[model samples]
Target chain A: MAGIPKPKLNAGQRKSQRGTEEAPFVKWLLITVALLFSLVFLLLPLVNVFAQAFAKGFTVYWDALKHPDTIAAMKLTLLVTVICMPLNVLFGLAAAWAITKFEFRGKSLLVTLIDLPFSVSPVVAGLMFVVLFGLQGYFGEWLADREIRIIFAVPGIVLATLFVTFPFVARELIPIMQAAGSDQEQSALTLGANGWQTFWYVTLPSVKMGLLYGTILCIARCVGEFGAVSVVSGHITGKTDTVPLHVEKLYNEYQGAAAFAVASILALGALLTLGLKTWLEWREAKLETLAQQAEQAITQ
Target chain B: MSIELKNITKQFGGVSAVNDVSFTVADGQLVALLGPSGCGKTTVLRMISGLEMPTAGEILVRGKRVNDVPVQKRNIGFVFQGYALFKSMSVADNIAFGLLIKKWAKADRDARVAELIELLGLKDLAKRFPHQLSGGQRQRVALARALAPKPDVLLLDEPFAAVDAKIRQELREMLVNLHHELNVTTIFVTHDQEEAMEVSNRIVVFDKGRLAQIGTPREVYEEPASEFVARFIGVMNVLDCEVREGVARCGELEFPTHGVADGQRLRIGFRPYAVQVSNDLMAYRHFAVLRHTYFLGVLLRLELEFPSGLIIRARMSKEEYARLNLTEGRKISLQIRQYRVLAREGELLPPEVSVTHHLGPSPGDGI
Candidate 1:
């Protein structure tokens, strides 16, 4: 058994072998491996976040959060999330609608372009906006004449957040909406419901859960968005600093406890996102069950 | 006319889904658009309901041209094949959906919804979601929703196609009864000929994106305009025949081929019940071998094969098939009790030429 024997089988035999469930030991081994993977990749980092945040005890963590710079970072992060979520969600609705409802040319191209932001580096996304709006970039002269500060200001942070989180909602909705097709909406239309009515009543209700799920993911990305926001924010404390930026500043200044405390807030934000994501998944599963139940109830 | 499609042609890209189809549905008629799958019957239903825009032609609803009108303004209620009841909406909300969109007052919407719910026998399940209801129940909800808005006309695309046979039968009966009670210009599409024949006052038979025939169910069944209609409407036996002395003859049977000259090749068709089976050889000129006898409870179906191996189906009671003891491979005397000259080789025969030379005329004359 030290050197595994290669007693090969034909394709059919191999297929038949695959049909059986994994052995108890093998199943446990795989489960253990998966657990280890998640613990190291996901759980460990999460635990470390909480541990570091609480390293200096309750007062220090509270003080770190209440600090003027930290407060500014928190507000900026929340504002970025608030502003970014709706914009991405709006784009998501429009993109999902266009991709699913109508037959259009360059549809696949548009879809591919939607996923482009997901594949592109967040730094690259930030740079692309910077190159467009920075002093010496494409729209530089026009913006310079008005003395507009989008490069190292809140607007730049918003733009970077927007770019990073753009695909979340649309990505969630596209496949679901495509599978749904336009049958329900078409029914509404034939029943004297106008385009807007059909969307508000039929289309919106069906996609509401997926939209929420996507919006949650989008918010998670927006709130926790670091690389893109960092590259654009210029790290001007109490003015342009997001929580992640503040964490970096604190960490760079060797203020380990303050940094961890700020990191804990962002960690909590991440936890919230994960929690919402898990909840949305559960809700979707429940919806699926209800849908299946309806189908069975009808056919049964 | 409740709905009229004049030269309606729907082209999907370069492919014609419904080609030059023209027909008018008279008000208060239960007209079933009957055809095989992919025969564009659904497209016709959609066009009438304003769900689909015909590439060419005018759609008139209540004698007003609706070609430019959007589906919402057409005020048509369409029930889909899958029963397209809003899965998320409660049965009550689903029904109230159209009414709400139409801006009906809350009181009236409630009353109308209640009326339809009761009309469609969905009283107890009013508050339940679509997923909670049975298939038949969902269909009832869909019907209630469609009719709730008091649409000018109701169009159902394969309404009973989704149900089991027992439920389908029940639905058909209830639908016929509903039509009778409401008399609200309803047009339903179905591939089931029996369902169409049972539920509709008239049937429009489509074949390969064209209207093969448009008439009463019996007319379509008994005097089908073409071979496609005859075969599509019912179980039919078609045979290539030769014309002689103004009579088209298939094997030992002869049918008066009016306006058809001698030596012309023709195709004649008849329904399963159109063939007469007798033990007496003198009763019919044709000699057929009884290839098979199937006891279908109420009626016995027979497959009688001619010498050329051409089989024609005929049905009779158990007592009748039993009396003849028409066992397998037995030579039996058979005659064309009634038949129609379906086509003249390459050309379609006129509807007038649906003469039953032997029986004088169909038992249901206008049928």
Candidate 2:
């Protein structure tokens, strides 16, 4: 009772048949422009940083690493990172857990507030702490009488780094946790697991990947922070100067090879962070494959 | 009563998910809350498990009021629709999690896990995580995990909603067997009528957050309480009729409407198997033209179109249908041997079973 249907046209013919045929030239033009923009703006600058870093060779690089001020700056950066990273990680985990696991009034507003630091400029973030803790600012006389040095000290630098890099872990975690859902936690509770037990056995394991990535991003930003550290640090080399601040000081003093070498350390740190991120991704994929293999083995 | 909901109601935003629902289950009873999606069956199950709080009314587990008890303290195991296994933990560890939380001895926990693994037939899959198991196997693990703590009650939310038909039947059978062995009071939510019929002894039918009917599977199927239950539980053929002098009259068929008033509009429903068809001209006093016939392996489903444009579905055995050598447009006499005056909600609740409606020509005459 049915005749043979007409053969479906191929893709190109189908597009023209539907009267929505887009010009191929425009597509190629967009692709080319995107490629050119990325190459000129991103690729070129990254290449130049490394080229200038090793221009005077390995011995120059070694001397730059050995400089006392450079060593001091590295220590201070590491100190700030070591202190700020854990505090921010805890905050991120708490914030993500609260926002995802519960329903309360003003919850959406609370989430947006956590992301405020990411949108605010780093220099403006530094100025906020400086004003509150400065000699002539709020609580200034109280702190001055107490003989506590905060504005031009290591603590202020740490605070500035903390403010600028606070959202990374939380931002990474919230979406993943939201997608993962509360079924598992609810299951744990029904299984007689308390709130803490459910969080430890169920919630934390699910969000560990996000936590790791967020911690890495937080560390990268904290170590390389310049504007905020520059404002709060008072530019005191070998004391308050972080790695990026140290590089600026070296280049300003006409130490071209040294500055590039110091900048290269920051660049290398970034590369290492990138390496760790990829390794984590590879591990995750491998875990997935292994789980699939296990499933197949059971079926067989 | 093992568990009871006294006028429980749950409101989300401004709308009620569960409205003024009440039920009680005896000890070791396997019951099902059967309904369509968004019918609040899952919400009722959650309230029983203490995972969701009712906006009004009281919930009592055994004799204690558990309205304020959190899910952890309620000691009611819940199997989520997703199976909610710990993706990171092995099947054994997942089963052991509840025991661990309750601070059972390490030795005791292991022994319980081993016992449940053997009971659930997850022997070799003990070390495997959730993703490593098939859907049925994961459900078994979820069941085993829920049973690990030996809770007084277990609530399963659409436990077999995510499996193939063959596996679903097997799981249903397995669940029935498990309940028999353990004899723990259990309640499960499911939209599948066949699923509820196969596993649960008691089926609570819900429609739009209201409890339509609650009875044994056979009772609900054979004697549905309301029009909604009649259509929802099984295949039913309903015809709009008018009551005239205590008789519900359609085109030519009339069914006794015992207590219904005269000149009232009514709907009469009957199952397909209730229709008796014949080839004789004056066999049953009512005749229809056979519009279509489908040869199913177990039954022959026929659509009989009447002169009044009303179509009635009738099913007979394949052997019987083959002997008749039926075709389309054939004159067939039909007699609705049994029928129900469809019950309206809140009107006398459920109509009593009355066998006095012998309002048809003899079935022997139809042959």
Candidate 3:
């Protein structure tokens, strides 16, 4: 048996119908374009830095690592990260708990203020700290007379880095905490658990993975923070220089090999961060799978 | 273990969720708070568990007031409707949670956890997380977790509502057995009437934020106190009727009634199974066949049309069907075997007033 003839299409009809047939190809083209852009902007820079670092063989890289100024910069960066990461994590947890677990006026306003650092430029963030603690700024004379220097010092660098990194942990933690509903806490309360006990036992365990992931991100950002720390540290060669500040100074002073050497360390740190991120993402995926399974089991 | 709720009322905003409700649950007895959604049965359970506080009233547990006492100090255990198991913990660890919070010794806590694992049939799944367990297994784990600490009182809010039908039946039986074995003052909340009837020794029916009735399940089902209770407990057919000389007159028929004055209009109700259907044409019973017949596995339900054009359901067993050879479109005579009269509007009456009257066959006599 023969089939019926298909409907005919006009020019306008064919033009309008073209998109649906080419939709998949269009999507693939868009993704490929984005991937190529990211490769040019991101991966190429890291590969260039590695190539530059190894241009004069490993001797120059080893000599740069042995340099006292480079050692001091690395130590300062490590110290700031170790000190600031935990503080940010703690404050982030407190802020998230306050925003999610309690009902108060101006909650949305407070949350916006917590997210202010993300929108603020790092240089402007450093300038704000300078305006607050510089020689002519508020509390400047008192701190200066007391020999407790803040601006143009390590303290200023740490402060600016901390200001820039504050929102990283909190921003990551807030949504995770919000998605875990209040049922478990209420259950704990009804089962004779006090407020502290409920939070410690029920609430903490549920958000532990998210909290750890956010803390790791905060540490990574604090260690790699450049523009803000540069403006505040004054780039004193062996006194207040962080890794990024030292790299900038070396690059400007015709020390291209040394700059790439230092840049390679930051690249390695970024790689470690990528690994941590992957681990955390795997954990999140596992949690989601388990949740879906639980839902299916309940329905069944 | 006696719990007294004195004029307890809870309001959200200006709307009352539980309004001026008062009842006592005796020690070691299981009471089911039965109602439809938004009727405040779950709210009442929550208030009693201290998850929610009443807007006005006092709660006394074992003769001492506990309205101001925190949940932890009150020593109550709650099994939520969703189970709410800690996903991070294994079944054994979940059951050991309350004991650990109480600072029980490690050895003692482990022993208690082991005991509950065996008692709840979770020994095989002891090391498995909640996400790894089946629905029935999860429910058993929740029950074990709630009961591990030997709480002074137990509260369950629709604990079996999330399970499948077959599992719900099994869980209901297990709940009844656990209640008896533990002898803890327990209050179970559910909207399913069959669940309440099966699991509770006494049932407290609520309607629109108020207590409708509190009685044994048998009494509530067999001798409901009001129209609402009668209609809610089981399948009751209500019809408009007039009382004359202690008898109800309905659509060319008169049946014996009690406590209804003459010339008074009232609503009358009877259970579907209480109706007697017969195929004998010589019988002088007062009924007409309506349009449809519903065949339930063990019983056949017939929809009867009276001369007043009112439809009523009459339930006949399989044996009765075989005896009468009943089928669709067949004319069958129905006799009102038992019924109750309810008061109409503007009549000064008790909150729950019903006049039960049985005509024709005596109790336990079948057609």
The lDDT values for all models are 0.84, 0.87, 0.84
What does the lDDT read for residue B135 in candidate 1?
A: 79
What is candidate 3's lDDT per residue for A18-89, written digit by digit as tens? Answer: 544767678799999999999999999989999998778899998987899999999999999988998898
Looking at model 3, the pairs that clash are A192-B72
Please rank every candidate by DockQ, starting with the best.
2, 1, 3
Please report how far candidate 3 places residue A211 from its true position, in Å: 1.6
Give TM per candidate. 0.90, 0.88, 0.88
Q: For model 1, how does the per-residue alpha-carbon lDDT over B1-367 read when each residue is reduced to its tens digit?
A: 3788899999999999999999999999999998889999999998887778899988888888998888888877788989888978899999999889878999999999889988999989988887788878888898989888887788999999888889988999999998899888999998888888889999998998999899997788778776777766666766667889998876666788688778998877787787888887788778988877776677877877778656667778888877977788888897777777777766945433333322122221212
CAPRI quality of model 1: medium
Off by over 4 Å in 3: A1-24, A141-147, A283-300, B240-265, B346-367
Whole-structure CA lDDT of model 3: 0.84
lDDT of residue A173 for candidate 2: 97
Candidate with better DockQ, 1 vs 2: 2
* Model 2 bad stretches (over 4 Å): A1-60, A289-300, B259-261, B323-328, B343-367
Clash pairs, candidate 2, are none
Q: lDDT of candidate 1 vs native?
A: 0.84
